[model samples]
Target chain A: MSLKRVGNQTVVFAKPPVILSSYSIVGPKEGQGPLGKTFDKVWKDALNGEKSWEVAESKMLQEAMNGAINQASVPKEQIDFMLAGDLLNQIISSNFAARQMALPFIGLYGACSTMALGIAVGSMLIDGGFAQKVLVGVSSHHDTAERQYRLPTEQGAQRAMSAQWTVTGAGSVLLGSDGAGPRVTSATIGRVIDFAVKDVNNMGAAMAPAVADTILNHFHDRQLRPVDYNLIASGDLGAVGLALACELLKQSGMNMGTNFTDCGVMIYDESQDTHSGASGCGCSSVVLAGDILQRIKAGKLKRVMLVGSGALHSPTSALQGESIPGIGHAVVIEG
Target chain B: MADQTQKKPLLSVTAEKYQTLIKQYTPKPTIIKNVVRAFIVGGIICSIGQIFINLFSSFGLARVEASTAATATMIFLGALLTGLGVYDEIGKFGGAGSIVPVTGFANSIVAPAMEFKREGYVMGVGAKLFTVAGPVLVYGITTSIVVGFVYFLLH
Candidate 1:
């Protein structure tokens, strides 16, 4: 058997890329969430003094990139590549941020699964001897995503009870061939799964199956059980998706038990009135950089599996009466 | 519709079965609570419009003029509240109550304008000004014209 290729879809990195540093910045609403204090910086307002919400999102991503580089004590000149993505069309947030950084840019679009996708690609690059250091970043804004995906910011339309609030946040992780932080040990790339879910509001339900698929595949590939990892966190399944995912996993004879929790459900309190919970590309990214990495650094946790689920649907496609297709990618971080 | 049903077989048996499984977990909307809130909020808004009409009539305006002025006042209030970012909250609580009123019409026009203002004046605000309310106006006008043509033939 090849050293890096584990089971069917998993890639066990031979020389695992160490996460040198991670940084997260969130808007005021996210700053008030449960993992609020863990974030490195929080803007008082969503706009962050920008003219538009799109610009504000790009600024957050740029700041996070700079923050991660600075925290790692790595000079900007030494970074080999910048890999990033966001929810905006053409990934404008990452593109705009990359313009200013002037680094070797590789813009990705895995929607909400961007964090895991970025880490997987970045780790592969470092381990393959393609690059020494890679910066992976992602950002999403509530106002920006709302206008793009649903309705205008000030529109008075009532949202469905299953709807999730888009998180306004950005996170960056600096990965290197050698470092002293949590190492990305493996990744499981997911398949695009579609169950013909037509409801645009209930994204959690649409993404739940993909989340279940990736998580199940990860466990099978690694030859491990739920107890093997300190935690198994899904990207942004929210409440409905998380419950559905648990049921699906149980049916498959792989119960996640207490170690399973969703980042979407963990980000907000019940009183937040976010219906299902928080979602977006930023949802998992901020949770990972702000909460998960911090816990790993402090020796409070050891191994973690981050399964990021993404609803790969567009406004145009939905309007054309197409069902939402979901994708998920898994990354294993071990301290 | 026929084409769509014919394409249903493209979905695997597992995909079709999974759809049924997920429906059990999805929460249904509270119909009774929404209906109650809509009724109460809608009644309150009409009452406020009535108060404005009474006030305008007391100032010696004709009954029709007073009613027209009250509607204008409501639209003005809606636009103002929308600008201040308060109408969305009311719309959230009131549901169709706030939406069925004249103020809701005003909001439909102003909301898109504000959202797209970043793209500049002509292509953004002017083009998208009637985006939300356009269909309502189209159907309303088309139905009125049809009614008028039928009335003309009968007369």
Candidate 2:
């Protein structure tokens, strides 16, 4: 079985999979952000009437997934697979949502990059003829991520200037071979690149190198220049990381001018006090499902490259003196 | 944690470049504003403690007793404010000023416990109760004991 491999690290789908439907739901805080109006649903309560924030995250994913399936007008039984994840221990949010939905599920954990991984795999499944229609979703709640990744908000802890606020939202995209929407044309799987950045507070620094590496690889593999795509977007590499990524890409002899932007940088208003910018799995997911796809459909962007970046570090790993390793997966979407 | 030196063989140059870029892009806090806020907030908290001391002293309490009463009262106020979720707001605006008070200590303990209350009392609230303020208490008690021992020896 010879897969249609690009130059290296990328797979080109002969028959690209179409994104049939997509739904985005954000919490009160994220609902008030720049992309607030673009989302399909915005919950008034961050807790979503749940007991704990973790459970609330699961609820968001459940709603987003159901909403996507409904928007696609596909029966639950007809959906062959569900690929989902979140920023939680064991990805409890996606797992819990899977239990509620009872769909054939594959749980993923790519830190903030879970959405890209899900869409990439879902696209592959559809393009390879394994499934006719697949569901891919990812979510992250600020409260849940705050407690798990750092100190609880109630602790009144001060965040570093480099720290990024985890986004409170969920986004789900339905992909099928037969639908009419922006198509997933190619995917570039990333390799773990550790630059020995150990500061848990500075996630942008930790993840920027991987974003640059993957983007460069995507360009090399597809034999495309920055001018080929109308937009080159990165997942959750906030203001700092976006700057670093742009510089790194430029040093490697590729120029990404105004075409380059980041989900982290665009999601929040500057006055929102999200030190660097917004992050988490939901950051890129909501932006892609809610804003970018809409722009593409409106004939604003013809081709776009979405690079999902993740800092693959645990608290235990950081405490044990391990340098944080990062990964960035890129998926090409053509309108 | 700071002792660990970053020494990736192949990517060291890239790391150096990234560090420079991060320093350039990361926002620096307004020091004057933060210092002024901290000073005002800290001074206000201390003044409230002084008021408690004066009230106790007026009620005919001895100097040491008055100080003790004021500290206890301040601690109570801090714990109350933390429980009501008001101290966190103060903390956001006041920074170290809010944290330097007895109330900040109360906020530290109650905040984690309250957030983790969903995990259950034993592992969640109970274990996490002392996480933020534990080191402060440990060092404070240890330093006092050392000082007491030195004074006893000198006397």
Candidate 3:
């Protein structure tokens, strides 16, 4: 079947980059709230310390980014660009991080969708001959997030079965113009999806609509079905969100069945008492950096679509009782 | 508080570190008959956990709390078996299919480190205490962090 390009073909994806280093930092056990240790440091500083959360988060992000870049055995001078983002208001996390990074930078605001969105842009830059070495990564946390949206980390509120476990970590990937990687084969930025569900406790309900619309738009643009890719991965939708997403896709006459897996669902053991499995910006990032990259390196999976869906909301919005406006971006990674 | 200054840290996923100890200490399962025996013993261990869960639930705990208690019970039993060297036999039979359960992980870790208890406090009690649980703590946190970041961004 012939493919129809969705957006302006300013750049056709070539080869992305390999994930040279991955680091995940968890919170205290059964703490009832969490965040990536460094992120929480920044968050706490923002909420309680001399510096803002953005400054703290960005500092930690740079530390993690440096950790990953150092692990890759690449010199700092070799990187061509820096791409980063998170759930902070107006992508301030990445903005602050960019200030410290002092590299050519692009700040993104995808809520939880930063990983895929970041990768998509990085790949485009690599494909369009815009960059040789682009550093892309994302982060999330439980404690800082809880403080931002719901209760304090010490609250110890009872979790519903559908509640998603917010992961505490950061993951970064270094994309270059050439060499070994999963290869950025194709991409589709579907029609922007927005809905009016804003309950902080029910993100799955809030984000599922966009997952449906964005995924459907991508499929329509590509003229491919769910089975075309070996894996149809979604970012940061826990077990319930995954189920809702599959149901919504099925409603569109595509039977994803068992093929659709959520980054939120894949990052943990079922028996971990994590409520509805993993959820975080890092949910997909680590899976992408740690496991998915390994699998791609091993040639086990081909043609994978990492769709990062995010909920754009703030503590003020939650308090003001405003509906959450969510978005999703699809980036295809192939061997 | 105990001075936590010194101790050789154990990496999580260090099953190879316990292999030698297991070979020397664990008794052969040939002393027992068949899967029935293994199942019976495993079943008994599991039953103890189930009873604990029920007991906890009966005391007005929620389902998750009860399950957590049950998990703790199973971990303790596995640790005991590991200490007695019987868990090695069960572990050989069950492989990870059985051992991947949190209880088995607890045993696999605690038994080996506790074996070095005779070496003294720093080596035995303080440092090696985490020999079994250390990696778990590491991976658990790392994994938790991974899951946390992913879900955190989803919002």
Candidate 4:
């Protein structure tokens, strides 16, 4: 019944919050990837002079957050809130970064979907007149993630062919109520979908259904088809997940066509030897912050939908033989 | 709660159907290729160990002592390679070949120790040194104990 509430699970902002500026900083590996030149800064080393990979990850997040804020030319004190998250236990990267930023921090834990979730929440804060400007950021590191989720960094275990390389990067976006940039017009918060995928290596397969569900909901709610957007990018669905998602969407009578692509697949090249593709919280965030927004600003892309997909399963849960639950959050950005 | 119970079975059915669809897209692991690579690499490693055994034997050590010294040497090499960050790449290429050897056992122990060393010596390396090798040791010793008991009863 509300004007903002759309068909089912979407919110159409009355006053869309504009993405004032965004900054992406990636490790050496990602900097060598296809979208390498698009990132704002590329660290020469993954450690970036930090003693530990965990510390490096937090530092990268801080650098990205500061870079975004500085690019927006907004005073630090004027920013209403900081929404940040990362692929780490207790979201230590974001929490540690927030400690230095000294802002009203809200640590999120949406795994890979943190970027879209943060943008959706930030837009709502602005559109609802609760905040003037908000900073949203997400980070993930390959070494740190591997240590926490899978095995030790130097462990000699052959990676599964379906396994994705966790992207070592951080991306931050600055949102303002009034700005001269692309606006976040609508959002579709997705339901957690578990297709009983137990293998952590096959994250793409685990997350495909969730992406399709969220995209379908977004289209239904917005009364817009796939053709309406110049690009509809899913977060970190990699090659396997993207293919499954396309097939699933087609079965639902929603043909995505050529306009649909995935951030994971786009980030790395086939020659990179990243079996499936790039993944992690940073995967979508960096792609969106670096490539997507830049294209929007350059007039190459108009309306875009970023559907961040996340495989929600802990190592403990996976060890317990529980199926991996997947989630996808959709944020529609219009130029 | 009532709604959840009613929807659970239906949800599971859909999930099952979706999994079948997922299988069509997921690529099968290259088992044959991996096995072949493993065989070649594992053979080369064992040959190197045999060479080490022969070298140690020429030094007047007994056959048993020579074999033991070769194993220790191989383990030391594995740990050294792991420290130098080369063993993981070898493991990647060799698959089970690199892992089935005594050197791989050393790698399993040394890798975690190196990774966790940052958390500090006492809690980090000391606690996690055997994280990957712990299961192997646990089951190996347990099975040996059981086998020993069986042998004693038979004797």
CA RMSD of all predictions: 4.9, 4.8, 20.3, 3.2
> Which is the winner by TM-score between candidate 3 and candidate 4?
4
Top candidate (DockQ) = 4
Scanning candidate 4 chain A in windows of ten residues, the lowest lDDT window is A1-10
For each of the candidates, what fraction of the native contacts does it recover? 0.47, 0.37, 0.00, 0.54
For model 4, the superposed segments whose C-alpha errors exceed 4 Å read B1-13
Taking the candidates in order, what DockQ does each have? 0.32, 0.29, 0.01, 0.43
Q: Give lDDT tens digits, candidate 1, residues B1-155.
A: 01222211112227777778777888889789999999998899999999999999999999999999999999999999899999899999999999999999999988999999998899999888887899999999999999999999999
Provide the global lDDT of candidate 4 against the true structure: 0.93
| Residue B43 of model 4, lDDT score | 98
Q: Return the clash pairs for model 1, or none.
A: none
What is the docking quality class of candidate 1?
acceptable
Q: Score residue A33 of candidate 3 by CA lDDT.
A: 32
What is the C-alpha local distance difference test score of candidate 2?
0.88
RMSD of 3: 20.3
Off-target runs (Cα >4 Å) in candidate 1 are: A1-3, B1-13
Cα distance off (Å), candidate 1, residue A246: 0.9
RMSD of 4: 3.2
Per-residue lDDT of candidate 2, residues A92-200 (tens digit) = 9999999999999989889998889999999888888999999999999998998887876776556778889999999999999887999999999888988778888
TM-scores of chain A across the candidates, in order, are: 0.99, 0.98, 0.83, 0.99
The candidate that achieves the highest lDDT relative to the unseen native structure: 4
Worst 10 residues of 1 chain A by lDDT: A1-10
